[model samples]
Target: MILYTPLAETDIFPVSEADLQKRHCVSHNGKQLYVEEMEDGQFQLLQVLSTDPNDFMNTDYIPGTILR
Candidate 1:
């Protein structure tokens, strides 16, 4: 799985396991990280660390960030 800094936009790109040959951009070390798949299969971005789900209820706006 890959990781990325979440955007504030409502339209989110969906990463699936069937599209492993795709490319994506992530932010790491104050730079934009580009990742490409080597295999022709599906993929998904799994968050290694995330905010508590309950925190969503208390905030009017949530800023998404990469955990690692």
Candidate 2:
């Protein structure tokens, strides 16, 4: 597979050590979530890892929603 874009590779796929450290995988409401730690000590939802389609419909698990 090849991507033919004028953007630099970093611009397309950025990876920062600090960003990685700030992110965590946690279980919430019996579902796995990828979240980033916020300055307020809360977590911002990044992605939902689940097979159930209904899990994605839950408001609490929406991307960008803050979690305790």
Candidate 3:
């Protein structure tokens, strides 16, 4: 099947509501982050939700970094 829309894939086929509920926002080292709770009692970084361009320069903020 072909998709022809300017919208992002996630916008076309959105994640489940339950999955969205599992995700949350947090602040670490003065940076705002979007993370998801893992089954192992740790949080996995989803996205760096910061407006500061400098925050994206840090490798630690890369998506999928596990947090305690």
Cα lDDT computed for each candidate against the true fold: 0.40, 0.91, 0.87
1-68: candidate 3 lDDT, tens digit per residue: 89899997569889998888889999888888989998887999989987888888888988889988
Q: What is the TM-score of each candidate against the true structure?
A: 0.22, 0.78, 0.79
lDDT of 1 by residue, 12-53 (tens): 665666644455665443433344433444223322222555
Q: Model 1 off-target regions past 4 Å? A: 1-21, 39-68
lDDT of 2 by residue, 1-68 (tens): 99999996558999799888999999987899989999899999999999999999988898999998
Shift in Å, residue 60, candidate 2? 1.2
Query: TM-score: which candidate is best?
Result: 3
Candidate 2, residue 6: lDDT: 95
Clashes in model 2: which pairs?
none
Residue 23 local lDDT, model 3: 91
Question: Which wins on TM-score, candidate 1 or candidate 2?
Answer: 2
